[model samples]
Target chain A: MNILVLLRMVPDVVEELEIAPDGRTLDTEYLRMIVNESDDHALEQALILKERKGGKVTVLALDAPDVDDVLFSAVAKGADRVMKIEGGDGGVTTRAAAGMFAEIIRNEKDLQPFDIVLTGVQAIDDLDALVAPILSHRLGLPYLAIVTKVTPDATGKSVTAIREFAGGVRGEFDVPLPAVLGIQAAEKPPRYVPVAKVRAAMKTSKIESIGVPTMADGGQPLLDVSHMRKPVVSGHAQMLDGEPEDVSKKLAGIFTERGLL
Target chain B: MSGNIWIVAEQWRGKLSEITFESLALGREVADGLGVKLQAVLLGHDVQNLSTSLGMADSVIYVDHTELADPGASAQASALAQLVRQQKPRTVIVPLTNVSLGTGTLLGEQVGAPVVNFCKDLRAADGHIVADCVLYGGKIEATVTPRGDLTVIGLWPGSRPPDKGRSDRNPPVETQTVTFADQPSVKLRSYIEPDASDVDITQQDVLVAVGRGIQSQENVALAEELAASLGGAVCGSRPVIDQGWLPLSRQVGKSGLNVKPKLYLALGISGAPEHLEGMKDAPLIVAVNSDPDAPIFNVAHYGVVADAMDMIPTLKETVLALRG
Candidate 1:
């Protein structure tokens, strides 16, 4: 079985985030980059699945030369091949990114045997949580989001995922083979790649592109960012004094006033 | 007359959340800004009668049902779609809870609207509704204009101003309750609520989060003491949550609860995107991390480059003195 994981190279959230002078998007200069957090989990899940079924894992990223280090780094963690989707930033719209990514799975050479494609429920950058569904629709594959636990049957090619819904609700879903999933982080964590292994793999790994796909309508910039400033806060931090009993009562009153209880 | 902006009131066990009323207030302001009316769409079993007592904003689109408590997303969507057909509201506002997102997503699709999730600011633009959101790890601001005939926005926890909204449209004595022709497919199998002891940081107005600088698990006692002194909840980052130092409920981030408290004071916690996404909406963020370069300072209102170890005792003294 073959597995494909979508890896995104986003600006590190640590430094002060800024949009480019053009104001079309994130400013790349003076920024550190990291792999999407959930994609790590997706990679880790794929590696574990590979160990059991003896299939290969391929990670696809829409990135630049700088992202090649990350692609090779993923190899050290366990994936077999890393495919880069080349071109300048504006890769795909939120609505169509998943569809474009699904195309990567179909077009990759010798990787057609993949049985599953996994993603984080939402990339931290987008937060729209739209990729898995859009990909599922374009690929005609079943999908689920907010998955907390997964149990894959060794005898069968299906994996069961339990997801958290609203009002603290839970849903149990049985996803069959060849389905895509937006894995919640706790479903698994992506293990780190050893620097030594990354260096060795970089010597031989080929980072190629499948061309950057855009929105069908020449890709309208979905959104424009005007400002990046911290919100002003009102009111001071209120402190509650006294014993535990008194504190509880005070909190209960506050909760009643706030309608939380 | 203020053109009506209706908030679909969500109730359970006869109790309504101020969250609903808060959004209603924001809706009223939006209505006023557009020279329209403010209305509320109240849906629940025998809930139409409670509109006025619950701060009836404008008109109310109430749905009554005994089985409404079952919480099938399809049912809520069906009823909301009916309301959309009847009232043709310019914008429909809902909380970001799972119940709202599931049903809201479905309704937005059926209504041919855009459902903007976790919006931080809202306004009227180009004959439609627009919002400014803290997107991409709170690093970028997205000013989104909801597209389609009607717009749907998921309000973040603390984005709306509390007192900037009010309306005077008398709650009509009785309102119409529309029925959904097609019902939900998923049936309710008796809900088993999580234990009351579930770490419920979302319910707190104030949060004092501790981070990696605690050095050792025993040092967590300092945080506990601070939580006790401040009468606020104590939550941790993924490291602390994963280390079993705190329950998963006390975990704050994208995977955990997305909370926006009145005041969030960070004690020795480094600011990572995963952790920042959870609490970025906190209106008054104060960081006391020893490292001046900790990412927590980017969004913090006040930065204390001093050691949190020393600040905790001083903070306790400052607050305790104020309480007197």
Candidate 2:
């Protein structure tokens, strides 16, 4: 079972993001980049599958800020190898990234066809959530999204997957082996790697670098943002005044006026 | 064939989802802007009656197949791909749901068309579609132009109201038959639904939703007491449910039930986009949290910057006294 996990670095969601002067994208200055939360889980999922099924687990990510740290961390957490593809300014569309990744997966001399590819169901940065599907399409592989559980068949030619539906409903599927899956969650909480172990792996492990041939306008990004502005609060929120007690009293009065009492 | 806009009207088990109508509402606008006709594409085993409800479209197109009775993403995508190939509609708008996430992506890939997913807003600009997309958990918005002659879009639910497309005139329904290749690679085996709760939050007129700020399981009782006093139902966000303080049925968000109660008292709920998408339509929203900068304040009709734990009990007492 050869598993490939795609990871991405997104802005630390805790920090405030401001629109650039162009009013189109985020302001990069002072922004802290962190491994997207779900992508971390994707790595953990791949590692668990590798441990159980006895295969090599490779972590793939774009060459973005703090990406090397993420790759080294994956190595410390038991990934067999890590690769960083050159190019990507943190704003590349998912389709463009998928195109590049497809090329790398197919052309990398040391790599073989992976039996399973896992990615976070969605990324916080782009939120288009198109990467895994586009990659699957580019590779002519079966694709499944919002998957929570994956169990490889005894023959290893197929895997049974559990997909999540609305209202907490779940569906089971029998997906073929050579497939791309958008993971909704890992089998368990991501195991924590001590900081010292990660630091040690930084000296022992080397991240393979690969250059990707850019596609047309880098996949001719489907849409161009003409303009952007802060989302207006349409509810016309009325801020209640005074202390908590006074506000509670006022809320009670409003509820009484509306007969919600 | 090239300029018309199409909406893949989504239905399951003979019923149309709300996002289906919402897609039509937005599709109508796109069609008008592109100077083209709007069409609804319905796929199911026997959905002729449901197609009539999409009266806003200029025409309704449907494909009835037994395999579609419980359509998975691959089945729907294969069916829609055939439709797209036959009728080269410039744009196909699909509802942004977990199910459509794969269907829409594969359909676009099948036709070699560009796809823009999770669109909150769309407009035609210079013969192209410009979209406003929410990113980083709705903290930032990006405007994108899906640069292609053919675009497949996943319209976010709640972007437009379903009633906006309501009309007296029923569109003509057109039926088409296409051979569906067996989707052997993936097959749906079974569905597991959450256990039913005592109170159906969907039917409740008022909801008091608690979030992580509620702290412990005991703190949940405060919100319950408040809900009881105000004649409302008690619910919680995903965190509370994950902790077993509430059942899965009581969860409200993109993955849970969408509720539009008359009043929503959000306690300690920092409005993530997922949670807000479910209840933002509530007529009167009152939020209480210790952090004033919580996103819940943006959609709330009334807000108080205080700990929900400190205020819930007093608020319940105040409501009781006022009712008397």
Candidate 3:
């Protein structure tokens, strides 16, 4: 089995995000980029499948700030191969990114034909989560999102995917091989790779660099952002005054008045 | 090109989801703004009766097919694309949800229409539509415009109140037929329901919700005590549920149960947009988190900048004494 995982570095939301001077983009200065949470899970899922079924796991990432560290870390986490597509930046829209990924996956000569392609269900930046579907449409492959687990048949002809729906309901689907999946979570939490291991892999492993192909139609952006800003604060909360004791006392009084107690 | 405004009605397990109604309310506003008819596009098998409740739409465009019975993204997208191509609606609004997430994007891809997702508000501006969208989990907002004659919008939930979308009048229902060239490759085999033994968080009038700040499973017991004192139930944010600190049924978020409790006590929850989508409708919200800048405070009626771990035990004791 040959499994391909797509990794994306998104602006870490834990830090304060500043709007760039362009007014339509984020400030890259002092910005921290980290592996999108679910993308890490996608790598973990691919690794788990490889461990069980004996397969090669190749991880691919677009060029962006701090993306080299993510690709190197994937190598430490048991990825068989890691490739970086150059000329791509963090500001690319999901549509353009999907186009680039499809182009690379189709044209990369050294990589083996992949039976499964996996990516995170969504990213914080691109909350619309259109990459997998658009990529699947371009590749003419079956697509499934919010998948929690994947099990391949002994014949390797198809796989059963466990997809999550709202309200704690899960649906199992039978998808043929050569499909794309938007992994919501892995069977286990992503395994932690130590800093020392990542450093060692950075010294030993070679990250294959491939130039991004000229995008079709220059990747016309479907949606254009006219303005970007912080969310307007609607109503400010009446902040409670003092120590835990005083606050709890006041909260209890309100609860009693509201008949919640 | 001038045309009608369309909303794709989402149904699962024979009932329409709340986001469907929310979309209708938003569609009604945008439609009224654009001076166009609001149309509800209902596609499902044996589900024509569901259209009666969609009175907000000027008309109900119904398409019944066996392949669309299970909410497969590809089949529904194909059907919707065909309808869009033929009908030429000005805008197609789809709810951004787990069940219908891929429909809008795939339809856009199929029909060569521009799509704007995560839309919080839409307005008619100078003969064009402008959408205010939330990005990066609600930290940043983007005002976007689709560059096309027809645009598909993936609307986020909680944009409009569901009650505003509900109406008593039955809209006109028009049935349409569509054919598929090939069967969808993804097939739904079975659905696993949540464990029935767990407490239903939606029914609780008072909820003490925990997030990553609850620290550990041991700390959850403290929250349980607080909930008991307040005659309520305990729920957690996605991070808490993801960490296995609570069962999936006890989760409160976009993928979990939507609860409108009388009093929602959010403890340590940073209020990611997904979590807010579930519980933002509560009557009274009070949040306690160490970080003052946590987004939970934005919607919270009252806030205390303190560690939830320190406040949970004290709050429980204080509530019990106040009741006595």
- Give the candidate number with the greatest TM-score: 3
Candidate 2 chain A minimal-lDDT segment of 10 residues: A214-223
Model 3 TM: 0.94
- Number of the candidate with higher DockQ, 2 or 3: 3
Show model 3 residue runs off by greater than 4 Å. Answer: A127-129, B215-218, B225-231, B313-324
Model 2 chain B scores worst on lDDT over the 10 consecutive residues at B180-189
- Give one clash count per candidate, in the order shown: 13, 8, 0
| Model 1 per-residue lDDT tens digits across residues B99-143 | 443455446645655666657667776555777765665445666
Question: What is the TM-score of model 3 when looking only at chain B?
Answer: 0.92
Fraction of true contacts retained by every candidate, in order, equals 0.12, 0.69, 0.76
lDDT of 2 at A169: 72
Report lDDT (Cα) of residue B66, candidate 1: 54
Write the residue-wise lDDT of candidate 2 on A1-261 in tens digits.
Answer: 999999878887556667789887777897889987667878888888888899999988987788998899899999999999875555787777777777788777567867999988777665444678777867777788877778888999999888877776778888987988888767665677999999999999999887766564456565666666556655546889787679889998887677776
Model 1, residue B168: C-alpha shift (Å): 12
lDDT for model 3: 0.88
* Candidate lDDT (C-alpha), each: 0.63, 0.80, 0.88
- Ten-residue region with minimum lDDT total, candidate 3 chain A: A121-130
Per-residue accuracy of model 2 over B1-324 as CA lDDT, tens digit each = 567889988886678888888888888898899799999999889788897789999999988888787757667888888888888889888877865667787787788777777688888877777887766766666677776678888787878888997667888988999787653457778887777746889899889999989988998987898898888889988557646688768989866778999889999887877788889988889998787667788899899988888888888878888778
- Point to the candidate with the largest DockQ: 3
